[model samples]
Every structure is written in structure tokens, then in C-alpha cells.
Target: MSAPETTTTTALMPMVIGEHRIAVEALSVLEILGPQQWVAIPNTPPMLPGALAWRGRAVGVLDLGPALDLPTLSAPSTRNRNAILQLTDDTVALSVDRVLEVCRAAADAIAPVHAASWVVDGGLPCRGEIELDELVVPILDLDAWAVASRRAR
Candidate 1:
């Protein structure tokens, strides 16, 4: 008999942003914070609207709605949560509607995102798309997003 095959799986944390369901790599997420009172910075883009104090330091809050061409969160709700992401050289909080439990999927389950898919005017960076329970979810590319946001500044 041949040797048993081993399957590799990827861990992802699904989140709700606006009306869309997306996910991020489980390893990149540092923590999730509840509704925070962020200070909007003047002359800043809508995507990077403001910053919030976290652990004695200020962390920029990323509003993916504008970037993803979706409706921005208006009224504050108790369900709102901010996911703190550890990017290359910076730590920022992602404003999300809700944070879901982490899940893992086989490598082959993830598919490439089409060009015509939902993206920003420039481009909404995505690592890939995975279908979880018949729902296709795009995995945001945080590193790429961070770089693009900086360049846009």
C-alpha cells in the first residue's frame, strides 16, 4: 500500500464588513477590541479615518468600506468589533461589523479571486477566496492593503 497522504489546511478568521463577509489570516490577527472612541485625524483619507489608543500607543483604524465600495458603518452598535492586525511594520485596527469564530479549510478549497470581483477604485487587495458553508468569502491581503494605503497618503 502507498503511504497515507497528508492534507494541509489554512486557518482564517471570518468577519463581517458592511454587508460583505470576508476573512483574514488567523496568524496576522493580534486581538479584537470592542466599540472604541476613535479620534478622526484631519486631512486623512476616508479609508484611514482615525486612530485609537491601544496599549499606550495609537493605532490607525482602517475602514474597509470605502476601499471595498461598500456602505460605511454609521450608528455604533454593541455588535461592532475592531480587529487588531499586525502588519509588516505597523499595527492597525480593522473596523468590522462583527468577528466570527476561526475556521480552517483545506488548501485546495481556496480559489483565486476574479478581476471583476468587488474591489476598490484602485483595487481591493485579496489573497484568495474560500467557500465556507456555501458562502464565498474573500480573504483580505492586509500587507498589500497597508502598502497601498501608505502610498495613497
Candidate 2:
């Protein structure tokens, strides 16, 4: 008999934004912080309304609501959290509703995003979708988001 095939699994951190369930690469996440006070900048895009101080540096806050066509987040509360993501050339905080425990799944389990509305500028920042415990979760692609965000500015 041939050798048993070894499946490759990837670490993912599940999070909630508005009513959407999504996940991010666990390796790319630097830290997760509770409700943080941010300084809102005037004349900025709705997706990027503010910045917060992190490790003595001003890190821009990214709100995925507008990007995903979801309603804007309300005032910060106990349930709100910011996930610091390490991008190619910078680090930014992603505002999320709630963060769930990290989980692992086979890499092939992810399927392409079927919702075309999620695409921005010819690309969607979502890597794909994966089903976990009967729930489908979209995987966030930070690198793609960073590139699209830069192009928007």
C-alpha cells in the first residue's frame, strides 16, 4: 500500500464583524486588545476612520464593516476588540466585534468566495471560506486588503 497522505493544516483565528463570521491567519496576528480609545481623523475614509497608539507608534484602525457592506460599528463596548495585524510593511489594528478561539484546518478546506459583492477593486481581501462546525467562515486576506487600501488612498 502507498504511504498515507499527510494533510497540511493552517492556524486560523476566528472573529466576528457585524453579522459576518470571518477568520484570519493566526501567524499574521500580532496581538488582540480590548476596547481601545482611538483618535478619529477628519476627512478620512469610512473604512479607516481613526488611529490608535500601539507600542509607541500610531497604528491605523481598519473597520471591515464598510468594506464588507455591513453597517458601521456602534460605540465601543466590552465586546469590542482590536486585532493587531502584521502586514508586509506596516502594522494596523482591525476593529472586530468579538474574537473566538484559534483553530486548525486543512488548507484545502478553504473554498473560493462566492459573493462577488465582497470584491473591491478587482480583488477581494478574503482568501476563501471554510466550514467549521457547521458554520462557514470567510478568511481575511490582509495582504490583499493592504494593497487595495493603499490604492484607494
Candidate 3:
């Protein structure tokens, strides 16, 4: 059987990383599961915090805070909930603290910033200079984050 043809639309989902607010591509998300029981992996990268027994599959959990240099949690506490982002063929499920809402913006909305001192500023493809009044949120590059996490291991 042949796969169905589909048209793609661009939209942004508001997500919270620790205290900072950010906007992520809505298409990158799989599902937002509740606080799940996870098994801690030894000697793994801090970004790849651990793995969770999700649907009989060992889903690699990415700690958004640590991955983005935000404050680390006191412990592995997912008591509230998390947004699971499917990155790179949905093989990895990244966990974020909260989901604010979804909004739409133009691709040209992203602009480059001049500051190149900070590591994140340097690494980002676009600096995101102009802030949207209704959808102003930090842009996160999951690909870069995943790579950094692996190298940190």
C-alpha cells in the first residue's frame, strides 16, 4: 500500500523550560504523557537524563532543564507532568516541564541576534532578535541540544 499524501502547515507550541518560556514546532511533538515511572541509567549524558518504560519500549528521556542549562531539579520528580517531544524519527522522547499553548508565526519571524558571546547565542542558526507581542517565546534547537547532550556524556 502507498502512503497517503499530506500537506504540511507550520505552527508553534508554547512550552515552558523551568521558568523560561519558549516556542517549539508543533510538528515535533508526539504525545504529552503524565508523570511516568523511569529507570535511571548509569554513566549516561546529563542531557539524556534517563529512560522511561513507555509502552513496553525503553523511551530515552531528555531532561529539558539540564539540556538547556536551566536549574536542575532536586531529584527525578515528574510528579506534575511533561511534554514528550519526538525527535529524529521519534526514537527519542524529550521531557519538558509544561505546555503553555499553541500559536502560529511566519518562518521569517525568526531573526538573527548580534550577541555572539554566549554559547547558545553562538550555536543557534538564527538569533531570534525580534520578539512577537502575542507569541514571543524562546526558540529551541532540539538537534543541537541532542548533539550537545551526547557529547556531554
Top lDDT model: 1
TM-score per candidate: 0.87, 0.85, 0.71
Off by over 4 Å in 3: 1-9, 67-69, 73-76, 113-136, 148-153
Show model 1 residue runs off by greater than 4 Å.
73-79, 120-122
Model 3, residue 69: distance off in Å is 4.7
lDDT of 2 by residue, 37-89 (tens): 88777777787777888899998888777766777654342238999999897
Tell me how candidate 3 scores on lDDT: 0.60
**Candidates' C-alpha lDDT:** 0.81, 0.79, 0.60
Residue pairs of candidate 2 with colliding backbone atoms: none
lDDT tens readout by residue for model 3, 101-131: 6766666765554332232553433234325
- Residues 53-144 of candidate 1 have per-residue lDDT tens digits of 88999988888887667765442322279999999988988988899999998888888886326753336688888887678888888899
Q: Candidate 1 or 3, higher TM-score?
A: 1
Residue 81 alpha-carbon offset, candidate 1, angstroms:
0.3
| Candidate 2: RMSD to truth | 2.8
